[model samples]
Target chain A: MPVFPRFTALAESLPPTVPFVGPEAQERTRGARFIARLGANESGFGPAPSVIEAMEQQAGLSWRYGDPENHDLRERLGAHLGLAPDRIVVGEGIDGLLGLIVRLIVEPGTPVVTSLGAYPTFNFHVAGFGGRLVGVPYRDDHEDLDGLLAAVKRENAPLVYLSNPDNPMGTWHSAAAISRFAAALPETTLLVLDEAYSETAPVSALPDIAALADMPNVLRFRTFSKAYGLAGQRIGYVFGNRETVSRFDRVRNHFGVNRLGQVAALAAIEDQAWLSHVIALVVASRDQIGDIVRGHGLKPLPSATNFVAIDCGGDGARARTIMDGLVSRGVFIRMPGVAPLNRCIRVSTGPEVEIDIFEQALVEVMAELNGL
Target chain B: MPVFPRFTALAESLPPTVPFVGPEAQERTRGARFIARLGANESGFGPAPSVIEAMEQQAGLSWRYGDPENHDLRERLGAHLGLAPDRIVVGEGIDGLLGLIVRLIVEPGTPVVTSLGAYPTFNFHVAGFGGRLVGVPYRDDHEDLDGLLAAVKRENAPLVYLSNPDNPMGTWHSAAAISRFAAALPETTLLVLDEAYSETAPVSALPDIAALADMPNVLRFRTFSKAYGLAGQRIGYVFGNRETVSRFDRVRNHFGVNRLGQVAALAAIEDQAWLSHVIALVVASRDQIGDIVRGHGLKPLPSATNFVAIDCGGDGARARTIMDGLVSRGVFIRMPGVAPLNRCIRVSTGPEVEIDIFEQALVEVMAELNGL
Candidate 1:
């Protein structure tokens, strides 16, 4: 049958596609679950028990919609970060918030800048809004700040995205470099500093909340999904200048955040001891992954994020083979999507058992694939 | 500090306002919790114990992102509705889904059609997309289908919203009338048939899925929040022509729905026994509320929804005073936002304890407001 007749021209012209095919989809296709799930970069150590307890306790309150203003969670987050509540806007997740920000700036043919393979979801949102994308390929396995800046200037891009302690390659630039990049951007360009992995990064790698707090052109995204292990809860927040964050209120699904997520996030925020313990576990797991990757004769990239990227001594096709091999063997890991970076496979930090399974599967799969 | 620069002119022009204020916000303002939580139309009876158990059991697995495609939930929902999986799209909630649909159709100054006092979130999304709204006021507290069709034709609206078993007024049109209305709308005007309250409604009020299934311009929205009692979980789905539903894939946050919400919704969908139990409670409570309204000398509108809207035998002003009196005395109820409809106070069905509290509060509140 013919589709709805009135989708906007941009929507009509767009193809039906998604940024990422989830592991669940793969499992369904394969008709079996992966023995070790490391593909999505989700925390395998799971949420703090206290946070779980809090969510379970309030499970009965599922009858109530979450606060439309998201008042208490925002107030608590504000107090925790030493920012005013007006400076923060909580959302379904960074994914949902990114869509909102893209809508706020991108009209038909508006230009947006980001690394070619930095975050496909962000790019998907830009395309969804009919924005023209200017993707600068990564330099030195890290986002090319200078290149992104040049592209933004040339295209007069209104939005640019950079993830600190970045994804896929799991490499990071120093906070100083990021701050300089933010300062160099034209006042008209908004930088979306996705700090989704900041909880596990070294303190020096992160800018203080106040360092970029006053920059209306810079908004940093954070999520409980990382070290807090509430990825499934779909809670994330972005805070910046009060005026910028306030604009989100104008268009957001006011009651979009669920009741359990609000409670889970609030409790997760309070359990700082658990966060610290999980960071320690993440650090240990990253080291263990590096050791295993090196043992396989692959060069493990230095990482401040929860995952380590191991150069596979080949191209994107070779890396895809390894990724597929791991999944077929019931060990799920991911790799970068573009060239240069795609020469590496990314393994996320997880509990010891899952990591051990990955370690065993990696050796066997590599041996079989290489005909060693 | 200056705010972010380069927001689209449309975005910059919007007011930073929310669609609805939650009862939690009211409690914070009053410095006391509502003794009777009847606002927001949430199922105060709460989700089934089995549903809560499922959530609690899955709490530890909150580390994984939900399937971006929401595969299992969609497949199960498709099976439940005897439709193909391609015709269903699960989302954060009905609200988020509506925002996506509006974005797909409405550009700046595009005309949209809705009832004068229909879902405010729908209006909010239309404005967010810079669409001009053409509203038809309710006729006798029910959506004026004739008027809506006239407005759509007059304005050449590309989109229209109609909520079956409607909110705020709790009135509904029969299936024949709704089908006629859908047939009357221009095919160019996509119709959003919101059945968010469908489960609580009488069968006579709902059009057969087969009747609207093949209509390219028609989409039906349903949620686990109402009869299934999973509001805090934030899971909702929309179904229509396969081509129409597929359009959501281009822009939806692939991973927007939460994992536990997926699990909870799946379990809720399977537990028809529990749904029947909740439906019974809602029916009894609705009747109880109707009796109370009659005893108080207020006229109760017949509701096909889970809430009862009682006309206070006065205008919006008197209804507002009565609503405020209830709020001041620790009752939480909402009145319609627009006039004519605003002449009534809406009360959501809840457990007997909450209903008793509402019954007691209404008598005292009315007496105090009328200076008895």
Candidate 2:
């Protein structure tokens, strides 16, 4: 069958691909469920009991469309963040919000800056909008702040993405260093500071809200998918200067955010105790993963996020072989897409049972690789 | 506070406004909630008990991110629609899907055609993408198929939108008429056939799936939001020739659909009995509305949708008075934005109790207007 031939050149140029192939897709292909789902950094610990109850209680109310403005949730989030509600815009997810931000700022040939192997979804959005990406390489497994700033300056890029407590490598910079980097950026540059893992990070790794609230060029993206454990809900928000944040309103599907997600996110916020419990479990899981990798003579990178990146003492090819072995054994995990970073396999902190599976799979995979 | 100055010219040109102000926003402003929510055409009858049960059952598993590929839901939908899975693409909602289709085809200065007063969300997306819209006015109360075809040919537009069993006016064309309209459109023009109200319409109002199945340029959009009563879940899908449907994958937020929504939609599809019940109730409610309007000396347009568009036998100002009076009396309702259509007020078919409130309120409002 012939495809409709009028899609814009930009749309036609984009490869029909997802940034990450979900574990569900893999299960269908493999014809078996993964014994461990540590690939997507989802909180396998599950949502709070209170949140589940709230969802159950309100599931019948799913007949009404969600409040297009996301009023109550935004009001609560405003109270939580110490900013006015206007400063925040709730969206389907951080990925969806990233796409909107890119659409607002990027035109064909527009320059965007980010770490070479940073969040692939952000890059996907930039490319979707026909933006030219200028990637700065990570230094020492950390998103190099100086390198990103230099590239922004060199390319005069309007948009730059920085994920503190970054993904893939599971690394972070102190809040002070991040604040310095934000302060050094040109006013013309819009910084997308993703803090999806903020709840799992040390308190000092996140900047004071006041430090960046005044800057129109910086929008911080956060979500309930990590420590709060509502990844399937698809609720994420972006906040900054009201003006910068309001740009989302112009193009967003006003009723796009699902109803139960708002209910779950609101309930999750009210259950801070549950979040603290999840964070504690995450810390223990991280330590357990560190020990497990060290026992196999691998180096585990210190992480502030909900996952650990363990160096396999080899290159990307070796990491791929180990990852493949684990996958064949029904253990799901991921690795960075680029060279040095790809040498490290990433595993999410989750329930001890799932982590046990990961540990067992890692041992057998390592033994098999040693034999080879 | 300073606004971010680096947004693209197109983004800067667009206004920050919602296509429709939700009843929740109005209630917030009014400092009171509407006792009867007949606006926005949401089913106050609510979702199926089975769907609610399914959501409750899966509430705890929300910790895992939704299947990014929407594999299972798409598979079930494909079976339901008698199409191959590759021909269907699910997204956040039909609204979200509409935005994606517009983005895929529309670019700066691209000419797009649609009914002048049809779904505002579609228009919002066109303007967001900097596409110039050529709106053909409605003929009588229904979308003018011939007028739209003329506009498409005149502008050499690459895209056109048609919502069967139309909104605001609650009128429709026969399936034969719609099929002919699709066949007549240029192959270069992609037709976004929104069937959001399909389940509520007469059997003859919808073309057989096979009627337009082979046309790459015809993509039919449907949702669980209306007769299925899953509006708040935000799940909608589009299907067409495999090659055409696949384009959505290139630009969509792969993980945008929520977890419970997928479950709810799956269960809703299984509960055909409940859907039949809702449709019967909607029919009764529509008749109830028609009677109520006629008793008040108003004209209710013949409807194939889950709403009644009642003409007040006056102009837009008179209709506004009646609508505002109903809202003030806590009976939420809406009207079309443009001319002759605006002479009518739209009320969604909902539960009998809400319709009771609407009837009482309309009686009082009309009496007051007459006295004035």
Candidate 3:
């Protein structure tokens, strides 16, 4: 069949592939579900009971579209952050919001800066919008903040993405270093600070919300997916100067955030007890995974987020084998896609049952790989 | 404060104001909620009991992100629509999907055509992407099909939006007329045939799926929001030529669709018995609204949608008066924004209680408008 001939030149030139292959897609190929679902950094602990109750109550009200303004949630988020509601804009997820930000500023050839092996979704959005990406490779297992800042200035980039408590490597920078990087960025360069894993990070890892609230060029992105266990709901919010944040209204899908996500996020925010409990669980699971990796003679990196990245004592090829072996043994986990970082396999903190499976599977996979 | 200095010239120039001021915003401003929430055209009938049950059951599993591939929903949607799974792509909702399509095809200076008072959300997406809009005015309370086609060709528009079983007016074109329009459009002009209200439309008013399936340039958009009563879930899917549909993945937020939306939509599709029952209820409610409008000597357009557009036998000013009066009386309803069409008010079909409040409020407001 002849294809439609109306796609923009940029869209037509794009590849017909995605950054991440979902576990379900793999399951379809493998013809079996993973015995342990710890691959995607989701909170296997799930959301609060109050959040489930809130969703159930709001489910019947599903006939009505969510408030386009996302009023109540923003107000609550503002109170919690000590910022005004106008400074916050709630969106589908950080992924969805990233796409919008990229669209707003990125035209063909607009320069963007990010870590080389950081979040692929941010890079995907940049490429989708024709932004020129300049990647600064990680130094010492952390996103090279100085390198990224240098690139932003070198390219005179309009946009830059930095994920504190970074993913894939399970590493983070101190709040002071991150704040310094933000301050050094040219005012013309907008900083997209993705804190999707913020809830799972230590207090020292996150900048005070007010610290960046006054910067028109910096927007902090956070989500309910990690510590709150609401990844399936696709709710995330961005906060910054009112002027920059208000620009979101010019392009956002006004009613894009679903009704249930709004209610669930509201309830999750109120249930601080659940959040604290999950944090403890995540801490324990991280430690447990670290112990197992160490016992197996693999080096586990210190983690500030919900997942740990373990160095396999070899290169990407060896890491690939370990990942494949684990998958074959009924474990589903992800690893970085690029060099250097790809030498490590990333595992998310989950329930004891899942961690136990990963522990058992890792030992067997290691023996099998050694035998091979 | 000076806004972010790096916003694209186009982004900075776009207006801060939006087209539709949601009722929730109004209630917040007025410090009160509306007694009859009839303005947004939501299904007060609510989702199927089975769908709510599915969502409740899946609530605890919110740890996992929704399938980025939307594998199961797309498969089920393809089976339901008689298209290949590759032909269908699901997103956050019709609103979110519309943004993707606009981004894929529209760049600055691209002329996009639509009815003068058609869905504002589509126009918002177009403007957000800097598309030049050419709006064809409605004729005799219906989307002027010929006018739209003429504009599409005259402007060499790359995209045109046609909502069969249209919004605000709730009027529909016959299946034959719709098919003819689709065939008449130049293959270069991509048609966004929004069928969000298709489930509530009479079968005769809908084109055979296979009839237009071969047209690579014509994409039909559908939603589970209307008859299925899953509006809060924010799930909508679009299907067309496999190659054209595949372009969505090039730019869409891979995980924007909520997890429960997938579960709810799958269950909604499976619960066809409940869908038929909602159809019956919507049909009855449409008649009930018509009768109530006629009792006040108002003219209600024959509708193939879940809402009835009542002609108030006056100009936009008078219609505004009646609408504002009803809103003040705690009844929420909407009217089209443009001339001739704005001479009528639109009300969505809901349960008897909401309909009763709307009916009673309309009579009292009309009497006051007439100085009775």
| Residues A128-193, model 1: lDDT tens digits | 999998989999999999999999999988899999989978889888999999999999999999
Clashing residue pairs, backbone N/CA/C < 3 A, model 3: none
| Each model's total of backbone clashes | 0, 0, 0
Determine the backbone clash count of candidate 2. Answer: 0
Q: What's the true lDDT of residue A194 in model 3? A: 92
iRMSD for each candidate structure, in the order shown:
1.1, 0.9, 1.0
DockQ for every model comes to: 0.86, 0.89, 0.87
Candidates' lDDT values, in order? 0.90, 0.93, 0.91
DockQ of 3: 0.87
Q: How much does candidate 2 score in TM-score? A: 0.99
Highest lDDT model number: 2
| Model 1 interface DockQ | 0.86
Instruction: Please list the residue runs of candidate 3 whose C-alpha ends up more than 4 Å from where it truly belongs after superposition.
Output: none
Task: Name model 2 segments beyond 4 Å from true.
Answer: none
The residue-by-residue lDDT of candidate 3 on B1-372, one tens digit each, is 887787888998799878689889989887888998888878888899998888889888887898999999999988988888998999878988998999999999999999999999999999988999999999887899999999999999989999999987888999999999999999899999999999888888899999988788998999988899988889888988778888998888888889999999999999999999999999999999999999988999999888899899999999999899889988888998988898998888899999999988988998898799
- Give a tens-digit lDDT track for model 1, residues B249-276: 9888888899989999988888889899
TM-score of each: 0.99, 0.99, 0.99
lDDT of 2 by residue, A79-159 (tens): 999999999999999999999999999998999999988999999999899999999999999999999999999999999
